[model samples]
Target: MIRRMIRLYGTWSAEYGLIRTHVLIFCSILEKSHKSLIGLTHRVSMDPSARIYSRFNLHLYDIVVLVVSNAWAWRCSTTSTLLPFFHKNLGESAHLDVGVGTGYYPAKSVHPFSKTGNVTLVDLNEATLSTATSRLRHAGYKGTIDEVQHNVFQPLPESLRGRFDSVSLFYLLHCLPGRMEDKGPKVLANLADALRPDGVLYGATILGRGPGVSHNWFGRRLMGLYNKKGIFGNADDTLDELKRALEGCFEEVEVKLVGVVALFEARRPKMK
Candidate 1:
C-alpha cells in the first residue's frame, strides 16, 4: 500500500505540473476533495475534454482566452478581427449558438434594435451552457432562451431543424475530436439542419497548419499545452481542408486566414 501510494503521488505530481500541482493540492486539501481528485483522474482517463471548463475555469475564460491568449499567444486581436466578425453576423431573430463559451460573442454583440430575441445555446458542458444562457438573459435578451446539452458530433434534435435565422459555431471546430476532414463536414451538415434556407452561418477557428498559418513561439507553446491536455484536437487541422468542408455543406463559402485563425461565413446550406 505504501509503495502504491508513492507511485500514485509520483505520477500525480508530474502530471499536474508545477503551478497546477500547487493550486490543485491547495484546493484538494483545503476542501478535502480527495474524491474530486479521483474524479478528475477518472475524467482525464475518459478524455472528457469539455469537463475542463469547470465553473472555476469559466471564470477565467474571457480574460485568459479572449484577451490574453488571443492577442499574445494566437496573434489574433479580439478588437480588430474576432469581435468585428461576430458583430457583423449578429443574429437578431431566432439564433442558435453551438459550443458556447462564457457567451462572450453574444454578450458583446450590438443589436440594431430591440433588446430581446430568441437564442438556443447548445454545448456538451453543463457549466458552459448554464453560463451562456444566464449571460444572454442578463444581457437583456428577454425572448426565448433555450438550453440544449448536446454534442455537435451527434445529430441535432428533430424539433430544432430549420428553426434558426442564423447559427454560429465560433471557436468550436478546433476543440472537437477527429481530423478536420472527418469532423468538420459532419458537424457543419448537422448545424445546417438548424438554419433557414437563406440563413447564414459564421464563426472562427484556430487553424493548426497551412501556408499562411503563423505559429510564433508563444502560439506553439499554447498549442502544445492545449493539445496535450485534450482541450484541443486541431493539431492536424488546416485551412484548405476547412474550406472544402464548408463548401460541402454550404453553397457559398467564404474563408480567410488571419494569424493562424480562419474566420469563415457560409450561406445557403446545400443540404437544406
Candidate 2:
C-alpha cells in the first residue's frame, strides 16, 4: 500500500511538479480538519496549459478513466442525457460542439444528428480536435463533419454566426480561465450568438459549491488543489451563478444540479 501511494505521488509530482504535489497532499490532509482553509488558498490566475485536460490524450488508459471510473460518471451521464435532448430538438438542423474532446459524446450520440444534418467540432487544441475527428470517422459517422481549431473565448468566424440550431458547451465553462462572474457569461453569449433564433443551447459544468462538493474526500482535495494551481477556474462558479449567466443570454433557461455538475438547457427567443 505504501509503495503504491509512493508511486502515485511520484507520478503526480512528475506531472505537476513537487510544489503542486505537496500542496495537494497538504490540502487533502487539511480538508479533514479545516475544509475552509483549502478554499482560502486558491490562486487567482492559472495558465491554460496547466489544466490536465489540455495535456490529456486519447489513449487506452484515458478511455478507461473516462468510461469506467465513478469520478467521471457525472460527465458521462450529463452528455448521454443531454446530447439526445439536443438531437431530438435539432431535427435536420446543423449542430456544433465546442471543446469536443476525443469526440466521445459526438461519436456516441451524433448518429441521430448526423443522419439528417451536419456537425461541427471546435476546440483550441489541434491534437484534441484531430483525435476527435478521427474517432468520429472511425465510429462510421457518414455525415459531414467540420473540424475547426479555435478558442471559444474569441468571437467565432463571421460565417458561423447564427449558423447552428444546436450548440453544446459540455464540461467547458469550468475549464476556462477567469472568474465565472466575468467569464462564464461572456463565453455563453459567444456561443448563444452562434445559434439561430429560437435554437436550443445546452451544456454541463463541474460546480465548485454544491451538495455533492464534499461527497468524495479525495475528489474534493484534488479539485481544491487543482483550483489553487489554476488548473480549474470554477472555484467560485456555483449553480446560481451558472443559471444567472444562462438566463442573461437566453430567453428561457433551465438548470439542474446533479452531483457536482450543473446541467442546463436554454433557448434563444425567435426573432420578432
Candidate 3:
C-alpha cells in the first residue's frame, strides 16, 4: 500500500499532488494503527498455553512482523541473516536493551538466546515495562530478566554498573536530538563506561541523507522545530559520523549497512 501510494503520486501533479500528500499522511497514520491492531489481535488469538504466563498473548506471526519491520528499518536479526550476537557477547551471557519499547526486540528476537541465557530489559515507560514483564513470563523465558524504569539520559544505577555483556541501543538514538552531535557522544561514552571491558554494544539507527522523500522547506522547518523540542533528530546518521563519534570511547568498531539503517558493534577496550 505504501509503495502503491508512492507510485500513484509519481504520475500526478498540482491538485492531484496536493491530494496525494494528504493521502500519504493519512496512510502513514493508518499504517501505525494497523500494526497496533494486528499486534493486539495476534495477542488475543494465541493458544492458551502461549498466554499461560504472560498477561498479553502474542502469536508467532506478530513476532515475525515485528522482526521484519525492524529489519526494514535496519534494527533487527532476521532468521538466516545476522548471527546471534547476544549469545556471543555476554559473560553471564546477559543482554541489556535500552529504550526497550514494549519489549519488542526481546519478545521477537531474544528467544534464540533465552535457551541458554537471560536478558535485562530497561525502559523509562512504566506501562510498557508492565506489558513486557507479562509477555516475558508468558513466553516462559528461562533467563533472569530485569525490567527497570530507568532513564538512559542520566547515569544508570550503581547496582547495574558494569553489568551488561551486550547492550542494544536499537533505534533509540535517532529519537533524541537537539544536541545529538554532542548528546550522542556523551550517551555512548556513558554506555562504554558501563560495559565490561570485553563487552560489546550493538545498535541500529536511521542515517541522514538530506531531506529526500520528506515534505519540503516547511517540512524541514517542522523537523527543526521537532529537534528543538527533542522529539526527533536525524532519522538516520551516516556510518562514518557514528563511528567517529564512538571512536572516542570504544576500541574497535564494525558497521554494516542494512538499507537506510546502519548497524554497529563496538567493543569496549580491554583493561591493561
Candidate 4:
C-alpha cells in the first residue's frame, strides 16, 4: 500500500507538471497572437486552428468554473434524488461521481445531511478546476469536497477505489454515435468496470426511433429525410443501449420513459 501511494503521488505530480507546461504554451501562443492581431482587430479575422483550440479550452474551463460556482444547485437535486439510496445503504458517508459536470451532484447544495456527506467531483477540464476552486473557497467550503480533473476512459484512480458508498452517473453515455442495439451493451460494460460492488447507479436520456428506420412511417417524409442529417444519437439507440448496459453491470435494473425522457436505475451485484 505504501509503495502504491508513493507511485500514485508521483504520477499525480507528473500529470500536474504536464498540465502546467501545456497551459503555459497555450497562454504564450494566445498572448503573441493577440498582440500581432492588434492592427487587424477591426477586421473579421479568423484562424481555424486557434479557433478550435480556444473552443476546446473554453469548454473544459467552463466545466471547472461552473462546477465550483454552482455547488448549491447540485446539492439540492442530489439530496432529493440520490441521498435516500445512500442513507438506506451506507448511512451517510462520502460518495463519488464520474463525469461529474460542474460539481452539480455534491457541492453547495441543501443536503440536510451535509455535515456527514463528502463528495468527490471528477472531470477532465482545467478551466473547470480553476473556477470550481475559487467558488468553493468563496462559499467557505475550502476543503469539504475533493476534486479531480482526469479522463475516466480508463480505470478510476486508486485513491477512489472502494471509497464511495453510492455512485451516481447523471446524463452521461450516448454522446457518441452508435446504432441502438450495439451502443447500450458496450457502454454498460464500461460503467460496470468502475462500479463498486454494492453501489447504485442512476441516470436519464432522451429516446426516439432508430436512425436506420424510415422517418416517413408516421406520415412524415420530410422529418424522415431530416433524420439522415445525423446530429444527435437517435432515441431508439439510447433507450435499448442504456438498458443493455445496465443488465450486465447491475443485478437488478429498471427503466421508465416519461414522455420523451427515459430514466434508469441499476445496482452493482452484491457478493453471494
TM agreement with the true structure for every prediction: 0.82, 0.73, 0.64, 0.52
Candidate 3's C-alpha lDDT?
Answer: 0.58
Task: Judging by TM-score against the true structure, name the best candidate.
Answer: 1
Q: Rank by TM-score, descending? A: 1, 2, 3, 4
> Which whole-number lDDT from 0 to 100 does residue 188 have in model 3?
81
Q: Compared with the true structure, what per-residue lDDT tens digits does model 2 show for residues 11-67?
A: 987976765576566555433333332343234132342223332334532443344
Worst 10 residues of 4 by lDDT: 68-77
lDDT of 2 at 117: 62
Model 3 residue 197 lDDT? Answer: 70
lDDT score at residue 86, model 4, on the 0-100 scale: 31
Question: Per-residue error at 84 for model 1, in Å?
Answer: 1.7
**lDDT per residue (tens digit) for residues 156-267 in model 1:** 9998998887888889998987899999999999999998888889999998887788797667867776776567899999999999999999999999888888999999
Off by over 4 Å in 2: 1-56, 60-65, 68-91, 210-215, 269-272
lDDT of 3 by residue, 12-101 (tens): 666677865864564354345445645564645422112121323233324433453334333444543333443344345767777665
Better of 2 and 4 by TM-score: 2
TM-score of 4: 0.52
The prediction achieving the highest lDDT against the true structure is: 1
The per-residue C-alpha lDDT of model 4 at residue 62 equals 40
